[model samples]
Target: MSKAAFTSDSLESTFLAYTRVLSQYREYWDFLPFAQFDSGWSEPKVAHAMAQLTETDIEHFERDATALYQQMVVLFPEVKMLPVPELRTQTRPEVPFWLHTGIGGRKLTQIQAFVATLPTHATHSPQHENVLEWCAGKGYLGRFLAFTRNSCVTSVEIEARLCEQGLAAAQKFSLSQRFLRANVLSESATIPFSMNDRAVALHACGGLHTTLMTESVAHAIQAVHIAPCCYHLHGEGQYRPMSHVGRANDLGLSREALKFSVQGMVTGGDRIARLRQQELSWRLSYDSWRQVHTKDHLYRPLPSAPKSLFQGDFATFAQWAAQQHGLTIADTEQWQPYLAQGHKLSVQVRRIELIRHVFRRVLETWLVLDRALYLHEAGYKVQVELFCDYQVTPRNMMIHAHYLS
Candidate 1:
C-alpha cells in the first residue's frame, strides 16, 4: 500500500458503516441496578411494559430521534452564541516553556517515569533499527525509547517550538534522535520519511493517530504501537466510524453521533476528575454569592465555560464570570456560610460517580473497537486485553498488534 492508494473518503465511509451496525446491539444498552431506587430501571423492561399497556408504546420508543432533537434545540436555543475558546493560538507559549517551571518540571518527570514502564519490542526487522514517533510532543517517549532500546528515533511534530525543545532535550541526553516539524495532516509532508522503521505513538489525540495508521499501512511499516486519545478531533469534526461492525451496519453516521462516540470515551477516572472540579467550582461560587445575599436560597446552575478556564483561581474566576453574566456581588463576608453547605457537594459527587460507573463498560467497548479496527486495517494480528485490572487505572486496556504481511 502506498500514499497514492489510500483514499480518505474510503476510510470515512468504512467507519460510518461500522458505527451504524454497532448501534443495534440492544444488549449494549442494558440497564444496571440503581441503588437509590428500590427497583431497578431497565430500558427493555420499560419498553416491554409500555407495549403491554399501550399499542403505540413500542412505536414511540422506536420512533426516529426527531423529538429528542427538538427538545435539545429548545433547551440550548442560543447554541450559535456559545463561547468556545480557540485551543491553538500562536501567541500562547509552547508547553516546553512551562516544562522548565516547577509545575511543568514535575509533570514532565512524571510522564518520563510512566513511559519508562511501558513495554517495548525489538525493531520490526533486526536489520532496520530506526523508530518513528508520531505526534511526538516534546519527543519525551522518543527520547525514552532511544535510550532504552539503543535505536535512533525520528520524532515528528507540528509545533516548531516543541520540535526545538525536543532537539534540545535530545542534545542534553546525547541521545540518537532527531525532530521534524511538519503537519501530519498533509500526507506529502509526512509520508516520504524513512518508511522501513518501526512506529509508535502514546495517546496521540484524534486525527494524528489516524494518520499514523494510514501512513504505516501505506509504507508497510514493520510494527506499530499506538494508544489513541481524543477521538472527536478529526477533520470531519466528529468520529467517522473506522469499522463496518455492529449497529454501524445500516445508518450513515452524523456529526452528532460522532460527538456522542467521543463523549463515550470518558472513563470513570476522567469523570471523577470532572466531577471534583465541578463540585469545587460550584462550592466556591455559591460561597461568593451567599456573601452578598442574606437569604438562604437554593443554588442555581452556573453558566458554562471552556474546561481550560476551570483551572484558574475560583474566587477570581467568579468575579470575572459575574461581569460576563451581568450580575453584581455586594458583600464578601457571607462566603463562609456557603462553604458550610457540604451536603450538596457530597450528593452531587456521589450521583455523578454512580452514573459514570454505569456507563464504564460501554466506553471501554468503544475504545477497544476503534483500536481493533485500526489494527485490522493495517494487516496486523491484534490482541485487546486489560493492561491493568485495578479500578484506579481502568482505562489501562492495551491493543497489541504484530504485522501479518
Candidate 2:
C-alpha cells in the first residue's frame, strides 16, 4: 500500500505483514506458543519450596536471595546498574523555575544529567516550535519543556481523563501546553511537522515507542529523546525483536519477563520484599483456581477492564466467586483462619517480586535494543546507560540521543 493510504487498518495490516515476514526469517515465532511460560512449575514442587523457605529462616533466605540475584545476572549479563552521580553538585539553580517544584525538581535533575551525557548542540529555533510528547499522561514533561524551552507542546494521550488532567495541570502551572487525546496506535494520529521541531517521549510503551520512531523518521523530526517501557505490549501482540541478534535467536521471554521490564523501569530494589509477596499470591491463586476448576486450566485472558479482580485476598475472593458462579466451595475449614488472618499477603508480595525479576530481564533487553536501533535508524548519535542502579530504581536506564547533523 502507498504510504498515504496506510490508515490505521492499513498500518495494522502492515504490522501483521511484518510479523509474518519476521516469522519467515525466524523459527521460534512460528514453532513456539506465545503463552509457553504460563505453564509454570509443578504445583507440588512450588508448594514444597514455599513451605521450606519460611521467614524465620533468615540465613537460608539470604543465601537464596543471593543465589537468585546471581541467577539474574547470568540471565541478563547486559543489565547494568545505573551510575547515580551526586545530584546536588550537578543540578544548576538557573536552569528553570519549574525545576524547583515537587517531582519536577527530581525530573529536572535527571533531565539535566541526561542532557549532559548527550552531545551538546544549540537549541533549535523557537519561531516555529512544535514538540510532540508521546504517551504524555498529565503532560508533566511537556509542561516543563513548554515553560523552560518556550515551545508549544502537544501532549498526546490515549485517555481523555489524562488529557483533561494534563491541560488542567498546564493551566495550574501557567505553562503553554496542550493535551491531544488520541490513541498512538490510530493511523489518523499522525505527528505534526515543523522543520526545526523536536519530539520527546518518556516511558512510552513498546508499540507506542515504535510508533514514535516511525513518526520521527517519517516526519523528519529534528530532535528526539525517548525512554521506553512495557516492551511486551507491542503491536503484534507480543515483544518484537529489537536487535538482529535477538531476531536470529530464540530466547525464552516469558510474560513475567514483560512485567519485570515495567517493574524495573518504574520500581527500584526497595519494593523487592513487596514484589516477592505478590508473586506468591499469584502462584497460589493460579494453582488453587486450576485445582478447583478442572476444565478451565488456563489463566483467564487479560481482562478488558481498568482493574484486576485478582488484586484482593485470593481465598476470600474464591469463596465469594464460588457463590457468584454457583460453584461448590471446596472444604478447607482449617485454612479459613489463616485466610481470614491475611497471612497470604506476604506470599502475594513474594510472587510479584519473583515474577518481576523474570519480566524485568526480558523487557529491559527489548527496551535497550529498541532505543539503540531507533537512534541508529534516525542517524542520530545515541548512548544507552543506566540512569540509576536497580537498587535505587529499576527504571534508571537512560537513552540519551543527540542530532549530530
TM-score of each: 0.53, 0.58
Count clashing residue pairs in model 1.
16
Q: Name the best candidate (by lDDT).
A: 2
Kindly list the per-residue Cα lDDT of model 1 for residues 1-405, writing each as its tens digit: 011111222333433433432453322222221112112334444333323433132123213233322322232222212221111111211234423432254434433433433444443436536788888888877876676566688988889999998999888778788988888887445544445467877667767887787777777776666655565566764345555442344234344334443343223464555655455545445544653454544444455665555565556555655665466665453444444443344343333333333323334345445556666665776544443222223233344455777
Mind sharing the TM-score for model 1?
Answer: 0.53
lDDT (Cα, tens digit) per residue for candidate 2, span 284-308? 4543454446576443322222124
Query: What is the Cα-based lDDT of residue 370 in candidate 2?
Result: 46
After the best TM-score superposition of candidate 2, give how far the Cα of residue 305 lies from its true spot, in angstroms.
14
Return the TM-score for candidate 2, rounded to 2 decimals.
0.58
Report per-prediction Cα RMSD to one decimal: 14.6, 10.1
CA lDDT scores, all candidates in order: 0.50, 0.51
